[model samples]
Target: MNLSKYLLIGLGVLSLHSCDDFLGNKPKGYTIPEKFEDYSKLLNSSYLMSSSNTVLAYLTDDLYRTSRGEIMNENAEGKLIEYTEFNFSGCDDHERNLYTFKHGQVLTAGNSDPLWNNAYENIYVYNAVANNILNVPDATKEQREAKYAEALVGRAFEYLNLVNIFGNHYDPKTAGTDYGVPILLSEVVGDGASYVRNTVAEVYDQIISDLKTATPLLPEVATNVYHPSQTIGYAFQARMFLYMGDYENALKNANEALKLNDELLDMKPYTTTYSTFGRIVLESNPDETFPEDVDNVENIFMRNLNGAGSGFYTAVVASEDLLETFKRHLAPDGVDMRLRLFFATDEANFTMNPSATPEKFKGYSTYAPYITQNAGFTTPEIYLIAAECEARIGSVSRALQLLDQLRDARIKNNVHYVEETDAPNRTEALRLVIDERRREFAMQGAPRLIDLKRLNREDWFRKDIVHSADGETWTLPANDLRYIMPIPQTVLDFNPDMPQYDR
Candidate 1:
């Protein structure tokens, strides 16, 4: 076996002919092994392919550190500038000022652009891996099942993200009438051709179908707490159902994920010193061993990172809005350890431009080093989902109990606790739950859009003015049409069968 070929096969592009050529270059640079029995190699490739752009995504995306002149200025100068000027406006301000981001641009096909190209290219890789696994005949029943499960989960994850941004949420009752991202599971390649888009309902149906089949087949084996599991699949189902307004199934599936992994990282025993608390949350070391020490108990699913290289993840500092909210809720006496663990503010202030006044960023970073991909399936989220679902079902007491349980984990043996009375009854409880979720998961980018959808605040957020650390307010007007990204124009060009999303 050639180590070079093995590494390249998993990481680099050997064939660039077209996406249709999944098995690029005849498996070049290595002698074929007597038996294609290396399931581990295939697994490694799956993980790598999923994580290939982990760092890039964080560096450039709005969910992380602002790519504007202040935070990332020293590192990614020009790229950050373009991102700040274009993507930032597109994402944060609803594409009002973007000169190039026309609704027609996204609706049309055969547009040779980077954004669409990259999305489809990544989908191509997932398709290639799935296709290869399907063709591997020597795989045992167990191996085949595992491979298929991974493929199903991977494709589902990709499609869900794409549809949410490119299309709209699934409304099964009216799915056929809605437009959705193109449903492409195969690795086909061609130039510009006519195509049309599917409805959001069709997209959700496919996602549910894939996950339903995959969850049962996934093994009970747990390699790392961060990686996907049967429970994670259930969590995704709960989340999807919640988005679909199916509260009953949402509650059921979220509870199922919690039952599988409900333990939270207790802050009580380790809160003697502020520095110690800081270590628990912010410090990342190569080998500061403490015997696991109950650190990641609440992590249901995580992405794994092995090195500090290009493809690995990075920390995205928090926005000022999130930081200020935490500060406002901080106990005047300093009893709230979560505030300390989650954020840090430097006394030194700097101005981006000379004419502008200096101000502190009050930036926040992750307390713990988790895998990238800018998202995780955590116990806290499960608890939050449970609270939301329960509240919807008139179980306010049960819902608040779940919320308090998570809140209790963050506060040390205190002088204080979240008063159950303050949490509100059923109707108001729904709003409180949404507020708690926004505060707790700030900048981690979990289901804020869903809350917006539920409250009919989608139009509101898309139109409201959001400010940064420097107090620059970015505004998105009502139903500006950029709330949903355009389907990559190229996708419409090549696939004549695909439908275009309306502007």
Candidate 2:
């Protein structure tokens, strides 16, 4: 039979009650899924496995937009033709608006936000499996339980991303009233479906509940990285607690995840001395140097940025601040394995117009036939969460030890790697953990922007982010309402009663 047709029909049926018009169209085929295998196919679909929220990267401080003078082209005569009127290079209007924190209409009224759309679309698939898997005719009890568990975990993952982007940071005092994205647990969308926003606390409560319920049902390790396991369940719990500022639970869950799989990918093997650049550079082909998500031992769960090859991973340059973080943490021999493996100067790998000076730009390296930048749970992330929690409530020495352990793997040859002898006070240790988090997760996903939101809760961590273009500057002050992204205009237009965050 035709599997693709059935897949489309299954998804189309699931989307019948979709809140937005994007998924309203009925498919041409009318086949309804009846076999256990049909529901299994829906869960294992590539659309569910590979979906991502890449647009959130534009709202972070990790990227830099090149100035007008830097965006140049050359004629046949080899003379440079600069676009004096253009403000930034290699970025479109939407990216420019997000990068500069424009006050109004970052996304046009009729347009959809991929971050919002991809998330809810994937949610529908998860809800389908979660709501109906047990009743499927031929599945064994164990098999049905496992699929249901996976769906719950997947739905929790999407809700976590949504709430973090669209809602206020989880302030225990205010979260009860703070608006979060709508919570839809069932696949049954009807014409009268309610699309009102849930409170931040309510949404987080649902995430925690889903994870707790799924933990026992999950296997110790998943069959593949795209599927959730007991380890990922714990890892996601740790992430949820970290965002909520619950240190004890975060550390407990983080350690639980690490106990299962704490391996970090050693980067030394991926580097080589290049005579052309007179320094160590990453192996230009990432397919050889970097393992695919399924094969990567570091990943507990894997969700890639959509169109990773052509989107944020390759198109934009690293901000000067982010590059400086790498520079400051360089080993005595001026080598950082992460810097070599993940970032490259324009001279090393030019991605802009030829006439632009190659020496002036540095972007996240995308030397590959395909790119898979994981935005999900990983061992290092858990280690960092554990370390940060230790710094906050447990032990400074333990925090330093964890940081040093991760650093030992990333720093070249362990040249300047020293054990934790002179431990800083708790405040300084926490600062170090926060800094290391930035270095590790720069431009990977929405971590930096989310970090800004959560960290701003403390007086010491509160700081303004400034962005400049075309001789104009925008400063997003700590705890600014802009940190909470407004509801997508299309979402608002469709659900008129839906409240939007004030910018």
Candidate 3:
């Protein structure tokens, strides 16, 4: 494999650089961190952006191009093609880059953009901690074990997301041959070390192995949501199992997570106002003086989105399909309270600078899934997982009971079971639970897109789904390789030994 410029920049684990220097500037008199405290600090740095990434949101059905016409917020920096992802009737050659292994602007090799960079970079950090922290002479065994467990859990989480984001969904039959991302558990030691990609199954095994081994070593709950805790570990395991289509294990781990933290944010209190625009206007100066109580409850292990370019996912208009879906769940008084709680509407008093054309921005709203999608597991997500698993295991009644627990909080006047056509049989119950998941986790961008990929393996949607916008449409067939992003050509070029998926 040819050496990559990105590798020289991002993969230098042995000779470290300061936070400000990406060009390998060795700060004056710097030394490798040898204290347990130093490695603990390293663990903290990786969790900074573990909470939410909006770039992944573009791949889901919850996003749509406006019907009036496609229009870029004059000042939007990420480019209009970034938003045209899900609904791209008029996407031209330039805008079609997202359909390949490389999701963002192909840089001059060393400066690959954020979406794929964030996860892998954190893995490197965790690997550094896990590989060297054990040698800290000043650390006690308990302290060493605890920090080791955290690094293991963190590495597992990063690898899990990396494989799903860069590799194909796990197909048991083909996983042995399917390409997952590189399994870089240890720090780089040799010169010109060409990294080889592991199979999807190998990657999943490592993730599960790390999580299970770390569970007993981790604290029952972290002092705060910013770091790993037993609950977060269990929650992540539940997520992994669900994605792997292991419903029994998914339900078991979700139940374990619930035991640790089962609180859900009630959408009722926050329903007093409705806006499609969200709390802040797009392209406006960000509102930073914000922090609320709701962020603590179900978000079991809170984290932040560390990537600099991680913003714009919430700046666009809500999909018309999403808007209409919310309308169908209206209460007896004809209101779906979630609409007000989850969206910042154009009808709201929020201001849009330079103002968008009315036809282009009418009914515009931004997605507000939680107080914000900062990071961590939510109580509601676990319940939905349990409910879906229940239906998958042929317990429709139990599933509806669990589904009601969520709907009662989101819909006013006790609008029960998501909608009137809720699920009658186990198949429909599972479908309803999945439907509710799309509604519940929209703008979240993680579970929804992952759900689409994993479910397609079972041929969940019999027919292809069409995404229509601005008088043009694109069809996405079930289990298509497009569902899984290709390993970036830059990555492939860097490591010729790495395997490529079908795409």
Candidate 4:
């Protein structure tokens, strides 16, 4: 297959004017797909498998921004030149706006948010397959149904991210009335067509409906992680149900997904001593040791962080709070494979710049130069989901057992890893599970922000977030309206009548 041809097809469908302009635009240079093979090729396109809303990581507490003045030095010419310190110097205005929770300021009318645009663009690909695959000539019933199921699951994954990022946290009381993202199911959009936002409840309902309809039609395991399988379908259901506070279904689906694939990557083998650092470090290069996102045993479904030009995945370092979490969760032997493998604190090895100062190494550097940060479903996430839901609806011991299983895999030289058994109540058990989630998934995706939004519903779990940069501090109070991100000004400009969030 000519991958470039499909790339052009995907790019041709994108329009800079607006959501409608992009969705309505047809492929100009390629032949319109008319057969099952062509549609299958569309589904198989690498463009649809990768890319996710990576900026969502900025809104979380996992990262801290460095001020320009902190990293700049005066040269012989008396001009200030910025030095790279773990790439934090590359943090841009949009990232700063998100980091500081500057509402209505992250984007301007002419500027487009990659999170919003990439999601909708991928949705167009999925919709194209879902809406027309059955009608394609020269395909068997099973093949058509299977391809259609894959598209539905793919589309649901995109909508799940869109609704969570743009809509408010799900509330049974207000979800039906709260505005969610616009739902576009048709493959082709009419000229000048406009779409009204769907309610949060309606959006969730559609997601659940699609997953339910697609699960049985999908294979037990996908040919690869890029394609959605029955396992991925169940995993997504588990995730969606957890967000909705339906612990029963969350636990049920988590178990179902785990039954299909529960393999976790053991991090101990990836650890080694670097002569330059004089201490343990993860493999100097991940490509040699760590599996690519598509081949990772832990991945149930693969969607990589769209880190190109976005520093969130590669440039951003761990915040003090996140570093503290790693320290707090270290095994009795003072070994946490996650911290050692995913982060670097040795200034010389971390930054690879001799000029880097000790002050610059206050926060650990993210060692993700080659390892792709997956924002999609993974086996360990399933374990965490099962643990959390079990803590809420089942025995606390059962929850700890599940949590211990995952920790044992990640921690080095662990005998049993049953440290959480002392919890006297379900509340303590749930707290442990939540902390484990932060440690395991820190700086990866939108999980932390989503956790904060949902857990704020409970008074016990509710807490404020404080971020400091350039001698100024901003606090986002629990349940603050700013938890919901504002729609990009470009999006609103395109559809003047579209309802916008007040945040």
Measured on C-alpha atoms, candidate 3 has an lDDT of 0.63
What are the per-residue Cα lDDT tens digits for candidate 4 across 335-368? 7788776665533343445444433343345544
| Clash count, predicted structure 3 | 16
> Model 3: runs farther than 4 Å from truth?
1-31, 67-96, 99-113, 271-295, 305-315, 346-360, 368-371, 418-421, 460-465, 468-471
Residue lDDT tens for model 3, 178-247: 8887787755534566777788999999998898888888876564676677887778988888888888
Candidate scoring better on TM-score of 2 and 3: 2
Q: Write the per-residue lDDT of candidate 1 for residues 1-503, one digit (tens) a residue.
A: 22221111112232222312233345532322222244334444533333222221221112333444544332234443221321232232222222223445532232343333444444554454555664566867776676667667766766676666566555666567867776666544322223346678877888898898889877775456534578878788887887788989989999898878788766544421122212332234412322231246766655432222221212334444445545443355544455454333331112224344322333334323222322446777888889989988948888878877876776644333243655456755665576567666543332454344345544322333243333344443343444555554344334445555555
Order the candidate numbers by lDDT, best to worst: 4, 2, 3, 1
Q: State the lDDT of candidate 2 residue by residue for 1-503, as single tens digits.
A: 11122211112233312222232343522223455666666676666766555565667677665576765656469887763322365666777778788875688555667777778878866877787778877878888888889989989999998899889999899999999888887555554344768999999999988888888999776778988888988899999999999999999999988888899876666653322221233466523545658877888898876756544544566777777777764556756667665665543433334344443232333222234668888898999999999989998878888888888877775543233533447777777788889988777648888999999879878888777766777787888888877777766665778777778
Model 1 Cα displacement at 444 (Å)? 3.1
Q: In order, what lDDT does every prediction score?
A: 0.50, 0.71, 0.63, 0.73
TM-score of 2: 0.86
Clash number for candidate 2: 1
TM-score: the better of candidates 1 and 2:
2
Q: What is the lDDT of residue 408 in candidate 3?
A: 79
lDDT of 3 at 15: 29
User: On a 0 to 1 TM-score scale, where does candidate 3 land against the true structure?
Assistant: 0.80
Rate residue 4 of model 2 by lDDT: 22
Clashing pairs in 2: 17-189
Model 4: runs farther than 4 Å from truth? 1-31, 68-89, 272-288, 308-310, 348-369, 415-421
lDDT of 2 at 259: 89
